[model samples]
Target: MKKVFIILLFVAVSAFAANPDDLIGEKFIDVYGKDEKGKIVKLSDVAGKGKPVVVVYWAIGDVDTYKVLPEINKIGKKYKDKIILIAPLLSVSDDKEVKEAKKLLHFDFPVWLAGSDSIKAYSIEKVDVPYILFIDKDGTIRNIMVTARDLKKIEENIKNLIK
Candidate 1:
């Protein structure tokens, strides 16, 4: 019994130490929404396109996330040709809010007004502002970060995905 308990503990620790990338080899769930231009876009369209895609999930009220908007925008423009940046504003139910956000963010890439269906498709339950999804060219989600506090980590992930 003691040996079995030790083996179980080892197994648990091993599982915990497993890399996040190893867990998501399949294609990402398709998330659809209208961009600031009122044109529809789908994650499926960009995924597997031989370029990395960064999807930022944020809400108007998330102050921290809002603070990082400029940085995210910079990332988008800096890697425009190498990758795709998609910012999805959560909890926005109308076009008016999207307009306000668009004017405020001024992101060069697409700023999508993600409706309930888009949020549901991602299986997001809470308003974890600044939630980020790093997807590879193969349509696999390499990382899902719930906060934007550590920009270096995100940058590193982006570099890895592109490289």
Candidate 2:
């Protein structure tokens, strides 16, 4: 029992140490996922480009995802040329599910099917829904918002990142 307790304690510590919040101000890690057309898309492909990238990590049936994605899509449209927006569906593997979710969500942005690998890279395996990462042109994560639904504040962050 003592040995089991020690192992559990170590696992808890490791998980906390790998928190995604620690990624703020750090160089964004490159992760690969499938685009709508089943083509592989790398985070590096969109990020480090000449525009700020907004990565929204969402799931299929999360209420917060449903609530915030439409608003985020508006921002994506408003700054379509100035910013790169990508919504990566966590834990979703099937392409048909992605298409259905995209239609139901009504988000106009690019939706990628982020599998276990991408989710693990982002350290969001146990994190809440609607996890947003704002990456600047240099591929550095500038800001992170977890479970945030405030559209104005989100837009403000995008504008700041653009400038």
Candidate 3:
């Protein structure tokens, strides 16, 4: 029983230490998923490269997700030359739905099919829609927002980070 407990404790500790949040200051996990075009897209491909990236995790048909898109769209256009915006719709595994969402949302940014693997890689907990992460040009996550209540603040941060 003592040996079994020690093994279980070691396993639990390793899992806990592997949480994706640990990648925040280090590097953004290169999650590969399909885009609206059904092409495999990697997060690292869109991030870094002397531009800050804003990644928003949303769900299709969620009102809150729809609500946040306009602001994100505006920001994307305003920072078109300096920053990159990406929206990864959660729980959406089909290319057809991704294409439909791209048209419906009229997003300026790319919409990706964020699968279960992406979710686990982000270490997302029971969070609300429009979970946003601001990654620096160096591919490090600088800010994270679980809610969209403070749009002005986030936009300011984005502008500052991109500069």
Best by TM-score: 2
lDDT of each structure?
0.76, 0.85, 0.78
Provide TM-scores for the models: 0.76, 0.88, 0.79
Pairs that collide in candidate 3 are none
Cα RMSDs, all models: 6.2, 2.3, 3.6
* Model 2: residue 54 alpha-carbon error in angstroms: 0.4
| CA displacement after TM-score superposition, residue 28 of candidate 2 (Å) | 0.4
**Clash count for each candidate, listed in order shown:** 0, 0, 0
Misplaced by over 4 Å in model 3 are 1-23
Tens-digit lDDT track of model 3 for 84-140: 888887864687777677678777688887777777777665456677888999888
lDDT of 2 by residue, 1-163 (tens): 9999999999998877667778899999899888989899889988987789999999888888888898888888999888999998885458788878778888878888886776667777544778889999889999888886889989998998999
RMSD of 1: 6.2
Question: Residues 1-163, candidate 1, lDDT per residue (tens digit)?
Answer: 9999999999998776534245466578787877777888788888878888898888886787768877888777777888888888786556787667767866556678776765655555455678788899988888877766677887887888889
Evaluated with lDDT, which candidate comes out highest? 2
Better of 1 and 2 by lDDT: 2
